[model samples]
Target: MTEIETIESFERHLRSGASLRGVVLQGLDLRGYTRELASVVLAGSVFLGCQLEQESVQAALAQGAMVFPPFLGLPYLPYRSGLYSTEELYAGFDPSRPESYADTLDARIYAHWSAQGRAHPVSIVEALAQRLHDHAITDAMEELLAGGGKHRKVVAIMGGHSMLRGQPDYRGVAVLARELTRHGFFMASGGGPGAMEATHVGAWFARRGEAELDAALAILARAPSYKDREWLSRAFEVRAAFPLSAEDRPACASLGIPTFHYGHEPPNAFATHVAKYFANSVREEGLITIAKAGIVYSPGSAGTIQEIFQDACQNHYNTVGVVSPMIFLGREFWTRTRPIYPLLEQLAQGQEYARFLRITDSLEEIVQALEEYDRFHTLSTIPR
Candidate 1:
């Protein structure tokens, strides 16, 4: 089935003279294309939340097409075609006036989500709309990872959102992500502050030098915590200082899977692609699932521990087909402070994924392990 998400795609498909059968058109305004709609084979076509004339809607229904009318009074497009970018989410934000964040699309959506009852909306319409939006986000994300005719080597870094800027752990995570991204790995994170922000921050500067990254880190240190008034402002300043060039975007591209479940924590500005969801469970599990190359666990608290076990379950059962490496970045943190690595090791005593488990304090080891795993997987998938 073909998906026509934009006017350009619809027009291109029409020019190609392809039948509209089994086509899925999403979030489009088809009032101008009534004639095209009338001429095409509409059987088996599905239209979601589209703006079609009454006559066109009736025509489509009569012609065996399924047309879902748009929901009224929604803050977001339930049928969005693509993932959100930093610019789109933070459109109304101003660096000088932090209060202006309330006017941003990201903040508005979080506000709306809160008003709708967070995880459990009382209205079925609201719940359904949120689900549809998340589904679209997942679709867009898959499309992004599938771009350029090859799957990205996605690597996720899980850690505490409380990890403050300028902290040694935060800087270490950033450097690790920067180096990994430079090696052609696509970085991913929870997309909030702390270590998550560092992950994207590293990827954002993948094309730059160490001195530049150090300078950015220094500027960010002024607002060490997300709770600070200047946190976002400092991030914006860093971005302004080192804007990503068009040529660098492809190489520096990274994913941020965040949710409105934790509305207090704003999404970081560093991730090139933002797959923000309404359900934290979906966002959390999906983040772990998509990091097929591997996941690096940084020092974190409960949320990070939750993700660690969640990842363990996936690798334990080989649930997603192939098990990937699970690297713990801080040996002392994982082995003693949190002491999760030892339990995980015990649980995976005779498992196939046991060999893939690694606990190291060295960033080089993390990068090398991921590279080696990616290389092996790439070769294994190649046709003889």
Candidate 2:
């Protein structure tokens, strides 16, 4: 059941004289490996969306191997090996020319999605390809959360995508995320603008000083809203000004789970790993489900409220095995403006997760609550 996702891995396995039996070779170009294919025992092996020569395909089929041909005329790889990176998605982007975004891979795929009828594609082929791509993304995402050997202590920040960059709430969320990330927790967000962008921005500068973060925030504040023409350019400028060093990339790593369902809102550039999805529901559920350490609710709108209850449902039933803390970062926003915290408190009156609920205005309190939960959970899981 070994998976060979990269050409290098496939070559290394072949060189080691390992049998290809029951192996899964995904998204590879096996045209040059026709000789290897003929030499190896291909029984029970599966090749997914691989570019194979006619002879190689025939040989694989004859040897009882399954070969899924690559999906043609698509802007994306349905069997992508890993999660999307900022560089890969924004390859054609130019900070100076905002229109250049229309040419980027992310934009191109979004355009394709729109042309294919958004949520309802006319052709089954298109729908199937999109589903396959999302499945591959989920697979790659799980690998990322696994972090090679160690599991990430993931904490998601849910908020409104409309939260302006220069707002106090936005700044608060960013600072909270930076501190939490520095404390060994992996930060995750919806991966669009507003509070989501702030979450990643904080994590992006986790290895830097507060002054540098303040400087970046000042630059970003020039384009307060994502609708502004210079919003993306300002972000690029900030990235160019204070780039993460090679040593910092691993430490500053964070996850962004964005969706093409709301493709108008481009995924933020700060998240080291982008798990972009076509289905917003799948993406939404997955984002909440992965944040096992806890979730912080920043000031947000309807989408944020939806996520709050979705998370509540998970905790209410203990659906994901262990219930994690649900910390609300804005006391006034959650208790009065939106007034969700009080209702949630009432719903969890006698529940086990009730003790885990926290609504605080202080960032320090939020950090302490998450850290304490991590400590308690670790000790509780230890063998007696």
Candidate 3:
């Protein structure tokens, strides 16, 4: 028995299904960047401490590949993986001060990202970016396999990023998420706190909710605000409350990827599989696009309303299969408070704009509208 060491052999190896997680491409002059690239492709690896200077950086960027230095101009040096050493990770955090964690770590991280103004400095972002990027591609590959192009099975639920783990709205969102998941749907969001967290939580509880949504809410109720005294603790407490039995283990799949770009808002630990990324713009734009199942407008603030119109445009053009279903869950909220429902109905009635719309207060009705629209679509597609 032997192992192949050469780059060509490496490509053959990856193509042949030998898996690689991280590959060291450090200190190598990328004169052979192309060959090394072949190795990178083969390993299905994210660039860690890899070098691509001179024309190599420019070349890779021109070819639409990411090319940045490891921790370029970072206040701190040597950026590592989503992979952080307990010390290195905590080098930035002080769990002793949970309250300050929201300030120094959470808000500070987003502030740093915002101030960067999105200038990609490789030295500062190389390792972190590569880890995040590779994770995205790997997950997308899985999703493509599951739903493929234009099926638009993904549905994102955006809301106030401040929604604490335990609140009526949080509980409501979680239950809705569970119902959607039970109907065989995958969910996504800004991947921060609040409604987004609830989405993942509900999906996590998708299997167990048949017997328990109230108990989960009760656990969350102890920490009603994201900025509450013991937000993260209560969340873990809820998870601990639901010890997975062997029989209940393989229930609905909950894959939620929360991001650190908005680290102040903790990623919901409930999402069994997470695809968290560091680039919020990339995540945001991608989140808006991939959702074919149409977004549901809950009683969120401005962010959610913005998502509403963004989704409307996507649906208006049938951007993602006749706009799936723009379901507004709260009648009073959508009809009276902000009042987007009537306006949407008016827009849909426009002869120029063909649309399918449902505005209701019933959670069951919301789910039914989605499934029914989907069924009608399936029937319409077949030759009559």
Q: Give the candidate number with the greatest lDDT.
A: 2
Q: Regarding TM-score, does 1 or 3 come out ahead? A: 1
The TM-scores, one per candidate, come to 0.98, 0.99, 0.68
lDDT per residue (tens digit) for residues 44-127 in model 1? 999999999888899889988999889889788999999999999999899999999999998998999999888999999999
Top-down lDDT ranking: 2, 1, 3
Candidate 3 positional error at 107, Å: 8.7
lDDT of 3 at 120: 56
Tell me model 1's lDDT, rounded to 2 decimals.
0.93
Please give the CA lDDT of all the candidate structures. 0.93, 0.94, 0.60
Error (Å) of candidate 1 at residue 345 is 0.6
How many Å off is the CA of 228 in candidate 2?
0.2
Preferred candidate (lDDT higher): 2 or 3: 2
Predictions ranked by TM-score, top down? 2, 1, 3
Over 4 Å off in model 3, which ranges? 1-152, 162-167, 243-250, 255-261, 320-322, 351-355, 381-384
lDDT of 2 by residue, 153-202 (tens): 99999998889988888899999999999999999999999999999999
